[model samples]
Structures are given as structure tokens and as C-alpha cells.
Target: MTTQTAKNKAMTERLVEWDKKHYFHPTTPLKEQQAKGPAHIFTHGKGIHVTDVYGKEFLDGVSSLWNVNVGYGRQELADAAREQMMTLAYGSSFFNNSHDVVIRLSQKLASMAPGDLNVSFFTSGGSESNESAIKIVRHYWKMKGQPERKKIIALERSYHGVTMGATSATGVPEFKNMITAIAPDFLHALPHQTECELGDSSAPGYERSIRGIIEKEGPETIAGVILEPVQGVGGIQIPPEGYLQAVRQLCDEYGILMMTDEVITGFGRTGKMFGVEHWEVVPDLMSVAKGITSGYIQLGAVMMTDRLRDELADLSDNVFFHGFTYSGHPTACAVALKNIEIIENERLVDNAKQMEQELWKGLNYLQDTHKIAAKPRAIGLMGGIELLADPDNGTTFEPSTFAAPAVVEECAKRNLILRPLIFGGLNVIAIAPPLIVDKQDIETIIATLSDSIQAFEQRVM
Candidate 1:
């Protein structure tokens, strides 16, 4: 064989070897992956694009697992890490002792977060952040002398995290099947898509339905309700008009704490500083990560309003009793501080607002010509393209057929990485480019996705 042929064979063999040995991927069928061998390997990234080991570049439409909002290879972030490491690598947030970086970051977050949510409890990632929030809400109720109000009401298809406690909060059945008797006090409300899928007006009816579920569940037994402003993994399902406001009203009336999981929509990913800002709703507690340090360092936080914090404080013996070893690590906090500075200085949040409009328009333009597209939802830099078996009837393609997955694979082949969201058997291709993505990059993503869907249609149909 020629030299080029030899190189290709060597690369393919390496991948096969990797598959045979060390790699246990998440949310994937192990047996199927073992049969298929190693998947695509990203070697490097610049701006909104990543290159594989084979030197093929692909648009990073998913932004490295929905983080990396500031994009890749930011030298300033690297410098911030280096500087912090040289000074103080790590420190515990235990007892009354803390680092300057951690203190400053907490104060900054308090100021930026909506309402009186001034307390910041740091965690290792989104999962832990959510886990902490769960613990805090439960503990707060206990402090209020209502330990019976331990139940948490979350929406179906809502994703909190993966830790045992946070996983229990996730309403998606697939994530909870293996763990039996997970959490006793958890209840799931209907999601916003119920009315939309049933071909009814989704605005007022959807809001009323969710409120009815909360009422049926008896708000007295519930401690809190957790929801994503825009469901990320749940096919980017945006709630209809007055949905969030109505939920807020119901929560207030029932004395239930409102928790917003901003793990995927915080720090300018949603064109604003946070996703809840879009609806002008103030959450009693907010869980944030991902863009906290632009994914430069491992950090997640739970912000609590003064009301909840005061409740914890009022109890003389209230321990609250939860923390991670790496909570408020000094170096991570320093990096986060610098990352926030970059975001503010570069005006990336404002850029996301503009890019969001451009991206929505671009995707809508494709929908006019692409028959497979349905229910295109776009807000800020986050969006989703629904793939339908019958666009006119809004019927979904079967999961076994894997039409959405096929489209994703085809897009990958054409050097564009897109994620397929499967919820209620509907396929939604989630599009969340980095906040730094430009008009040219948006054009490329749209063209690539449109072509991929067309190619899949030609082959599958």
C-alpha cells in the first residue's frame, strides 16, 4: 500500500485498539459502541471550531458538552489559572476560613444574581451544585420547623444532575430506572410540551396544567420546584407565555421554594447574564455552572436568597450539614473571577443576543425548505430543530429508526457537530454555538445542518 494508505490504516487500527481497551462513554450503549469501535476524537479547538486528530475541522455547535461559551484556547483564562496556581493552588471553604478569590467571587455572584440571593455555596460541577441545592432546600424547611415538607416537585423531562440526590430530582425515567426507591419525596409535574404536542394552544393551557399538577400534589408537602428556564437535554423545550410567571405565582401562593437550574443557561449562554432574566422571574435559589469560569476550571455554585439564608441562620443549632471537599477551591475561584471579567469586557453576553437573532433567522430560513424540520425553538444562542416524520401533522420519527441520530452522524461527516435530543420520542437537534460565534460561523452551521437533513432524507426515505 502507498504511504497515505498506510497512515489511514494505522489511524483506524489505533481507534480499534482504543475501543478494545480504555473508554467507557456516557449515555451510550456499551455493547453497540464495542461493536462500532472508538468514536470521533477531538484534538484541538479554536474559536467555535474543533479539529480531530486526523486534522478535520468541525464547527463546535454543541460547545464542548454545552459549556465553553467563551470558546476555546483563551490565553487570558490560561494566564489567570497560572497566576492563581503560583499564588495559592487550593484551599478549603470549611469552617470560617476562606480565600480572597472565593470571597470576591461570592460577592460578585450575589450582586449579579437576581433578588437577594447573596449566599454562594460552591461545588465541583453542575451535578453537585444541584445536589447542594436539594440539600439546602430540605434543610431550610427543617429549619422552619416543617420537616414534613421534604418533597421536591420537578417537571417531567427536567434534568437536575447525576448524583444520587440530584439524579432523583431528574424526572426523566431512563436516568432513574436502575436506582430503586431513589428518593421518597420527589414528584414530577407535566412538562410544557404536553399541550404543544397535543395540538392545543400551549400558552395559557400549559401554564394552568402545570399549576394544577402542583396543586394535586399538595403544595404543603412540597419543599421546592426545580425547572430549567429552557430545557436543554429535554429537546430545548421553551415554556409558553406566562408559564414561568404563573409557576412563580403558584409557588408563592403555596409557599413552595422556586429553584432554577441555570447550569446550561447561565453566564451569557442565553443572551442575558442568566436564563431567568429573560422571563423577569426571580428564583428563590439558582444553581449555576458551565460558564462560571467558561469551563476553564471545575466550579459550580448554588446561590440562595437572603430569606433562605436567614432561615438557616435563625436556628441556633442549624448545621445545614453538606459540603464538598473541593468547595470554593481558591484557584478555581480566581479563574472564575478572571473569566467573568473577560465576559464583561468583551461584551460577549450582548454578542450572544445578536447571534441568537441571526441563528434563529438562519434556522427558520432552512425550515421553509426542509420538510423534516418542525417546531423550531430559538432563544438567545440556544436553539433546537425538531425532526418530524410528518411535518404537517407534527408526528415524530421512531427511535429505533434513529433518524435524528442519522442526521447528526451525517452532519459530523460534513464537519459540523450537533447533538440529538430524544424526549417523548421526539427528535430535536439542539444548536447552542459559543457566545463568540460570528455571522459566518452561523451560516456554516445552518448550511451544514440543512445539507445533513437532506442527505439523510435521500438515503433513509
Candidate 2:
């Protein structure tokens, strides 16, 4: 019975009304939603699809906001949460109070994280993970008695998160437009999007960008550089080859910490355990979330290196302060453990590699077909098809045209949903389907997106 009954129908409408009237959604186009009620009153989900209140099912091309790595409605995860709730739901992790689940999860993360990033600090989600990253970076520097090194550098088109600290690091203006306040000393650098196109002769390769920023900001004031190896929300912008290595060398040269925000590219989303592996680079710190629990529960973690840990221990006899009340929540930890187990047992990461090929192939075919001068950019299961304004001229449409949203709406008409990234001169449809997505799923998504692009092209012409 996917259809809502008369009673359920009445309640559903009421709930939609309540949501519009009271729900304060984050990162949402609030004014538009207030006028349109709700785009989807989703009620049920399973595998890679979700059903709405009207019994309409749509392919989750964006993986329900780029998470749900193991797909939706996993019984195993639910069971794990249930068991943990029944056994040990609430336990204080503060003041050295701890639990077994978090300890084990930390050990697992230590084993998985690159380099000596052996410590795990928990948070409620990506925003908090990055929020913690900034604080920990500064606190680590402070403990070193170099309190002046408070500035952070992140790449343009890089998105860390939405918290004050994270928002300051986010490169997209839309994420920061509403905020009247932000943390000071957050700097920006160029992303190596043209490394291949321009070859090594590019004026600002990833290395030069970081070095130039450090030189201008005075490396003494810079604490670290934080960026996504695969810029997910930033149009799934895949960093050029050797980009991570270049940035790593610069950070080492400047005695600055290198941090990777893997909130969107972590887990199996990038066809690797973590996004940094694609470039074979390890950083002093890493912030991760999203796929950590496959969106079953709210959870995030930041990994710290042994060197930083030891230094902080040596310098600070005083207690260090920072953490959320739900940090290492027992139930969330249990679900995360189960989620990882499912990924391994099902071999979702390997599946992602196999499926990613299908995705790119479909995207390549779709982009090449419509004479729209589209570029398909992706890594693993995450990527997008970017539409250009003039195919022959390689120019982008003016911002007033709303090209990306038009594609989004056209695709929606075909029962395919995608996220539109229309910021900082990027006009593309971003997608990160569940790692369990198959070839047919890829074909459908690509076909629908292609049709949308064609429709947009006609309108523009």
C-alpha cells in the first residue's frame, strides 16, 4: 500500500502545510519552497529509489544529497541501531567517559585513514566535521605556541560546509551570502581545473596556487590548507592529475597542515576508500561524513595525525575543549559500523568502480550527442554533465538565463531528479547515485539528463 489512505492523505497534506509553515530547512531555497509547498513529500525508500506521498517513484540520481552509499532502507543498519538503542543508547563521551562502539569505530578508522591520522573526533555531520577541523587546526597550532598561525586556505569552488567556520572556508558565494558574520583569516586559492587543458604551462597549477597564497598571506600566519580532493558540490570538479601531490609538497615546504574534506567523496563514492587515494596523497588531517553511515544516521568524523596528537599532548597540560553532545553517539556509531560492514561484505566500493565506468560512458555519450558543448566530469559514482552556452565558442550562458535549473525541471518531468549547481560560473547537473546503482540506472539518468539538455538548448536557440 504505497498510496496514502484518505486519513493518511489528509495527514500528509497537513504535514506538508506544517513543514512549509514551521520547518526551517538548511541550504534550501526557502522563499521558493514556501510558495510551492513541498517538492516531494517522500514517504518510503528502498534500494536506489524513493516513493513520494503520491506513490510516484523517482531514481535517486543525487543519492539523496550524495550520501546513501549502501542504498536506502537497509534492514541490517536498522537492526544495528535497534540493538544499540536497546543495549546502550545514551552514554557520556565527555570528561573521558567513553563507550565500546566509538572506540572500535575509531580503531577501524585509524586502520583505514592514510598516514598517521590515527585519532578520530566525532561530530553530528559534515558541517561539524569541518567546523571541528578548523578548531582543531588552530588549537594544534596554539598548543605549539604559534598562536599567530590562525589563517586557513581553501580552494575556490571548494565547499567545506555551512557552519560559521566551515562557511568561511566554503568558496561558493551562495553558501555565504546570507551570513552577516564569519570567521576571520579564511583565504582562497585557485583550483587546478585546467591542468590538463593548459598542461604544465598553466599560470596557476595547484602547487603554484597554494604557494602564491602562502607567500602573499605570509606562511607564518597560515595554519593549513583544506580542500576536497574531488570537489563534489562544486560541480563534481575532479582535480587534475598530480594536483593533490602538488598541494602536499607545498604544505610540507611551508610547514603547514594539509586537510582533505571528504564529506562527499569519502567511503565508496569515489571508487576508493577515500578521495585522496585517487592522487595517492595523505594529509595531516581529514574531515569525513555523509557516507559514514550512508545517511542512516547523522554522523561525522575528523581524523588527526599522530604528530599533531603527540604535540598537543606535549604542549597542553590544560584540558582542550571542543565537541558535540552527540559526538560518538552509541546508536549512530553502531549503524556506521554496520554500514561499513555492508560496504565490505557487499563489496560496494568495487561495485562503485564497475558502475562508475557505466556512468562516465553514459555521460560521455549524452554530452557528445546534443551539440551543446557539454563536459562530463566525475570520479567513481559521482559526477555531472555541464552544459555550455555556445558549443562552437565554448562560452557559458549568462547567469540570468537559469540554464541549469531548466534542465533540472525538465529531468524531473521524466521522473529523474538531480541537483543543480549554478554558482561561480558553473552550470551543471550534479549526481552521485547510490553505489549499488547498475548500468540500466546509469543509462536512465544519462538519457533523461541528455533530453533535458536538448530541451534547454532549443529554448536558448
Candidate 3:
């Protein structure tokens, strides 16, 4: 080998060794990864693309775990973070201590949030945001003298987070299988999208599922219902028309709080500032993260309605003990403000709205042309293309066949990265690119998927 080749190989070996020795990656098979190393050692990123250590490029179709809303490598975000760190790097948001950026960021979020969602509680990421929401609402109910209202309900196949409370709240079995019994009183309801599929069944839709649960537990024992406005890890399942509205109505009827976990769909991911905006439904609480700061610095927030905030305030005169050390971190807040400014200044939400049509048109064509594309659906930038062995008969390959992973690999070989959700008997390819993606980027994504699907279909044959 040449000298340059030798150097590259040496670097790769060193990286692999170091990672295997020290880095414990999340959601990875530790033993297998330690033996085989990472699939790609990513080094840098730009708008809509990421370059591996080997200098190969790939479209960031998964938006780097559904964050990076402004796309990658925006110097402005860097500058914003640097400027804030230089000014005020760290400040304890404890004891009513606050930073200017944090205060300003809170005000901005309140103004943008729908209905009376006017208060903000900060965390380090989505998981913490969700866990925090659970505590906040349950605490509120307790203060209101309803200590029995401890049960929480979520939609099946939904993903919340991995913390004890958040993991218990998550509806996916894979997330809970490895662990022991999680937080109690966590329940699952049938998703609205699947309701119509089970035609003529006694159980109709989300309404009945939730209603039945409430009846079984007694409404007085339930604290709240937490759900994703547009399900992400649960196969990008979009709520059917009037679905959220019906849920909101149910929550009201049952005297239970409703929280929408917008961790993945918030901040322009769904062509709107918030996913629930599509239904004009005002949830009592909202869990937000990921796109909040475009993943520049870890930041998450729980936005509460004025009514909920006031209830907590009225019920408690003592210090309500709940918050994170990095809660409302000045640097993160500053980065988030700058990121939101960029999103607004660039009209990224509107761009997402327009590009979604482009995405749907392409996915629709793929669905018609490729028999593997059993059902392709997109709402704004979040979507899924369900793969099947035969669309005519709705024949799906057995999970052991690994068809979804094969299709994802096919896409990656073509310099496009896509997330394949294979668990829970799903063969879904999640499509959620950065909101700042342009028309050309959308076309490239579509073409890449089209070719990948065709290749995968041929390989299966």
C-alpha cells in the first residue's frame, strides 16, 4: 500500500480500537459492535449531508436522529454558542437565578406556543423532558389532593424515552424487555391509525381504547394521557383527521391532563412550529427537544399551559422541588434562540410545507411503481414507506428475513442514510430529513429511495 493508504488504515484501526475500548454507544449491540466496530465513523457535516472519516458523503435522511433541523454545520449556530459561552457560559437556574438568554428564550417559547402554553421547564434532552412532564403533572394532581390519579396512558407503538418513567411511558416492548419492571400505572391504548384497520372489531379506535382504560382504572385514578402528535419511532404514523381533536375531547371529558410528546415533531419537523398545530388542539403540556437548538447543544423543554402553571402555583406555596442542573443552561438557551431565529428568518417551516408535497409526490410514485412500497405516507417532513413482499396481496416477509435492513443498506450504499424500524413487526423506513432541505435535496432523497427499493425487491426475488 502507498504511504497515504497506510496512514488512513492506521487511523481507522486506532479509532476502532479506542471506540471499542472506551465508548459505550446507545441502542447498539455492545458485544457485536466491540467485535466489528462502527459501520461509519462520521467526522463532519453540511446542509443535508454528512461525510464519514473515509471522506465519503451521504445524504442525512434521518436528520441525525431527527434533530439538526437547520441542517448540519451552520457557522451561525457555532457563533451563537461561542458568543454566549464567552458572555455567560454557566449559570445555575436554581434559587430563581436566571440568565438573560434563558429568560429571553423562555419568553420566546411561550409566545410561539399555542393556546395558554406560557411557561417553560428546561432539561438536557427529550428523555428528561418527558420524565419531567410526567412528574410535573402528577405533582400537580397530587397538590390538587388527588393522589390516586397516578396512572398514565400512551398510544401503542409510541416511543417516549428510556428513563425509568419515560421508558415505562413508551409503548414499544423492545425498549422494556431488557429491563425489570418499570414505573407502575403506565398503560397503552390502541392508536387511531390502526383503529380503522381492525374493522368490525368490538374495539373501534383511540377514543374507545382510552375510554375503556379510563373505565377500567376509573377516571379518578388517571393523572394524564401522553402521546406523540405525529408518531416517529413508531413508524411515522400520522394521526388521522379529527384524531387529536377526539383525544383532546376525551381528556376533557375524563378530567385528565393531555400531554403531547413533540420531541421529534416539534420546531418545524412537520412543516409547523408544533405538530399539534395541524389539529388546532391545545394540549395541557408539551415535551420538546431535538430541533429546539437544532442539536447544537443539548436542550429540552416542557411547555405548560397558563392554566396548568397557575394551578400548580395556586396549589403549592412551598418550593416545588423539580429541575435539572443544566436546566435552562445559558449556552443552550442562546443557541436555541439563534436556531429559532435562523428557522424563522429562513422560512424553514414554509419550506418544509412545500417540500413535503414534493416528498409525497415522489413517495406516491414509488408506492405505485415498486411493489415493495406497501404504503407510503408523509405529513410534512416526517413519513414512512412500509415495505412488503407483495403489495397486491399485502404479503409481508417474515421479520427473520431482514428485508428492511437490506433496503436500508442498499440506500446507504448509494450515499443516502435512512433509519429502518424493524422491531414490533414493522418493516418501515422512516423518512425525516432536515427542514432546511431544498427541492434538489428532496429529489435526490426520493431517487435514492426509489433505486434502493427496486434493488431490494429484486434481491428478495
Per-candidate TM equals: 0.93, 0.95, 0.96
Task: Please identify which of the two predictions, 1 or 2, would achieve the higher lDDT against the true structure.
Answer: 2
Instruction: Give the alpha carbon lDDT tens digit for every residue of 46-76 in model 2.
Output: 9988999888998889988798999989999
TM-score of 2: 0.95
Report the alpha-carbon TM-score of model 3 versus the true structure. 0.96
Backbone clash count for every predicted candidate, in the order shown: 0, 0, 0
The candidate with the higher TM-score, 2 or 3, is 3
Pairs of colliding residues, candidate 1: none
User: Root-mean-square deviation of each candidate, in angstroms?
Assistant: 3.3, 2.7, 2.2
lDDT of 3 by residue, 12-125 (tens): 899998999999999998888889898889999998889998899999998989998999999999999899889999999898888789999999999899999989999999
lDDT of 1 by residue, 1-461 (tens): 99997898798679777865788887777887788765677778888888876788889898878889889899888998999899998888777678888999999999888878899999988999998898888888877888888888788888888898888989777789867768777777777644432324444544435565555666667888889998898888888876787778767878989999999999998889999988899999999999998888899999989878877888746455688899999888988988898889999999999998888888897789788887888888899988888899877787887988889999999989999887568688999988888999899999999999999889867
Of candidates 2 and 1, the better by TM-score = 2
CA lDDT of every candidate: 0.85, 0.86, 0.89
lDDT of prediction 2: 0.86
Candidate 1, which ten residues in sequence have the lowest lDDT sum? 193-202
- Alpha-carbon lDDT of model 1: 0.85
Q: Top lDDT: which candidate number?
A: 3
